[model samples]
Target: MCRIAGIFDPVAENLQQRIEGMRDAMHRGGPDSAGVFVHPQLPLALGHRRLSLIDLSEAGHQPMIDAELTIIFNGEIYNYLELRSTLKHYGHEFRTESDTEVILKAYRQWGVDAFEYFNGMFALALWDERNQQLILARDHAGIKPLYYSTDGKRLYFASEIRAFAHAGKVFEENSKWRSAFLTFGHLPEPITTLKDVVPLQKGTALIIDLPSLHIKEHRFFEWTFNGKLKQEDEAIALMRETLEQAVERHLVSDAPIGLFLSGGIDSSLLTLIASHTRKDNLHTLSIVFTEEAFSEEKYQKLIIEKTGAKHQSFLVTKAIFNQQLDDAMQAMDQPTLDGINTYFISMYAKAYGLKAVLSGLGADELFGGYPSFQQQKKMKLVEKMPESLLRGLQRMPDHRLRKLSYVGLQNSAAEYLSYRGIFTPVSVAALLETTEKEVEDDLQELSAYYPVQGLKNGNRISWLETNFYMQNQLLKDSDFMSMWHGLEIRVPFLDKEVMLMAAAMDPAIKFKKVPPKYPLVKAFENELPEAIWKRKKQGFTFPFEGWLKENEYIRPSNNAEQKLYQQFQQKKLSWGRYWCALLMNRFTPLP
Candidate 1:
């Protein structure tokens, strides 16, 4: 919803210019207004770029400061109204009817303990003058991103990694992260393409003590699948209720809101619920492709007819892709194989004058809607194989079948890698000019960061999908791409309360029915149109393979990239692999 940047040091001079540069780099994120706050005693400056979603007045402006604390926040607190009421009863006062103010008051009422009380996506930094320390925190689900770097002299933090360069931080290309990106199609969290720059972990808070410069981190939340089981009927009812509440809470915005309907169960269900909450002026946005195989216009129409909501559609063709591809690529602040879909969709939403929209992003990970869920069962058969044989198989030729071999030899993270990875360790080594052993070592380090601890089967797969894929790729991509167009894309399924409810669900209930997403489809079966819920699940995608042929700006140069590109031209390369190569070449060209 906004862009925030700050620099903290006890003796840095010309701090305002540095903060302003970071703020200007994120100008697209918040074109409505800009503000900069310089701390009186502490050598700190906070810069903000505002899009004006909530209050639409000067009161909602930031870097908002009171007597005790000054804060720069980038997110929405859905439960702010409720928290504000509670804080008022506790004798807290407010000047603006904005969630930004609510966060300040909440922090006043309780210290860092206030993060657990919030149930929305956020990445924020609050300078606590009273405590003589600075506190930075991210939302529980990592829906928003915060990037930071330090040189033992000054600490710089921003909403996007690109802003760091404008803030005068030089970073050499990181080979390990390049290898990781080539392997996974995106870099995992807490790692960036630049050396020494890091993403603050999700569900965690970072505190920097002012003069001493000591930093301590606290993990405020982590998603787990182990929860008390409930009866089938009871679980379904609770999921429905929780989802409805999450949708309603997301509807709390001052500007007009819309839905990105993919004509799938998740978006349709959200539209159905949102229709009940806001009957009029509920716009739904969709994209139809000239390649009919990639179009969901038919199902989009079905949902439109059922909800009777105002509809807008973008007809994407080769010309559209050609015209928009370059700009979209330039708009990317980070290198990613995905998010081109999000970038185009958010562009259309902004052109339609909608400030905020709801997207059904996290539904697949939470409800077992991906093939990885079913594949996890088959992957378990690997446990019967001998460890010596499995280790030998790791040296096998890198191919689709060979990757599947690795999936069986290990656990959920390995299975997820086989299913979701873009390149094998050998392939990444070749591409990044690194050794296969180094790539393997980087992957091993990445696996250690994976949240899949002791979860089993479907739950383990869910953990990997949510933590590895959703957290690293989907959520980060959604944030930068959408925010690039100054649009706020809200994900109700990623709501902390909703995620908690889903985590408590028995894995047995997740895909018990056909088309997967068993609990969601069953809970709303009567309400959802049969034509919509009964169809085979289709991913939200555009016709990229055809367009890639015509786009010359994405060509590869060196032997490594050229090799991958040649395979793509021969149609032997997977789209994921082609995309990975194209983006890497486009963004971080090989020197």
Candidate 2:
């Protein structure tokens, strides 16, 4: 829960100005304190902004060093104490009780292998002074962020992209990235909106040798769903045990902690476990929507009664929504269509005097909890058709039946892309001032790089939904939104141990035809209320349609929305068009 930045140059004389500027940009992330470590002989500097979570003492101050290594780290190492004990037995000495020191010492003993031994979310950079090498690494699932750029002579790294702006690196507004943004409502990872910078892929590490200026990226871990347990009962028991341990580990903070209870099964389970583990009465925060279709207050009330935890709820009115929307949009150092909910909720937790909040973000991806996962059987029927026939089907008129036929004809990635896309390729091309060929080219490029495997027609949809949709979009939104408020959001479901176990379970067991996330619901059947178990999954959704329709300040004037609304009023276009227009306007920057 901190911000880290650094500069490495072969020719530059000093890095003091660059380090200070980067630290200043990340002040919001860590308002407690700041530190900088500059290599005495080399033109290298590492900077840190402290959030003061675990150790409140100045001893925890970082750019932490052990004999020959210096480190600038962001994120919690939950297993630090255990790792510390292990290292101490090997004759490693520690000057501070901070996890930062633990990381330094562990690396001293284990080298890059230290990453595998770690069991927490992190994005860290360590400089081995003796070796004259810098090691940069991110956690397996990417709970934290790390961005970097290199010009063959100099390398720069930061926790946030805005830090680069302060480092005097001008970001060119990449129209190619903008094109992808217009289609997907997000600029997918490995590629940021900026042309010069790239996010280090999750589960990967980079080692830069200072003398040679050679950089090598290595994969440390990958999520796999192949390791199934022998027995169903054993799987359930193991899941419960692993989750409780993760909850306990994540609770290791000096500040007050709370749970972001959505009243959904995932959040409810977290609340239940945390209430037992935490000595203090657990504080639960929830958001209720003003829109009837979107509100989940009734469900929240049920959980509050069942758990009897001290509960606080906010009713998000149109006025509050409008204000937050504008603030959130402007908060976008990178554009995102999601995370407005996360931003406001984190803001609420901060106002309530909580520094860390637990969320159940990765459960849907880990377990089979999306509608697309259940639609696997339907997709298999389409895979049986010949390629030529399917190509012919896609050119049919844009009617409801024709749309379904077109969907049936698409390849695995294309079908999954359609599911996650805010606008169809046809619609995006028509709306954009650019040529259709360009948009199609971008889509094809994205499709080729889309990171899902096991592309059999049926379960391949599930694979794509988890890897591409959840990884690139949902998780990215959660990280930025929560960090924006200086609040540390720990997702218990994303704990490595929990994820490995969940991945091992068969899809049939996870998502039965009767109810989605069936195994999870069954495991907690007695613990949860009947209403909660029976209720349909109401995802975290904003009332974008209603908001656009009623907004008076920013009325549509001969624009896409206005034209679409006119068609709706004239009984030509349906409500779906209005929804599409609103999404298009939100994602596409106005002239």
Model 2: lowest-lDDT 10 consecutive positions = 401-410
lDDT scores in order: 0.83, 0.74
> For model 2, which pairs clash?
none
lDDT of 2 at 290: 63
lDDT of 2 at 417: 49
lDDT of 1 by residue, 185-229 (tens): 888876787777788888999988886668999788988776565
Residue 121 of model 2: what lDDT?
A: 88
Output the lDDT of residue 575, model 1. Answer: 70
Overall local distance difference test of candidate 2 = 0.74
For model 2, the stretches where C-alpha displacement exceeds 4 angstroms are: 11-14, 384-412, 447-451, 455-462, 552-591
Best by TM-score: 1
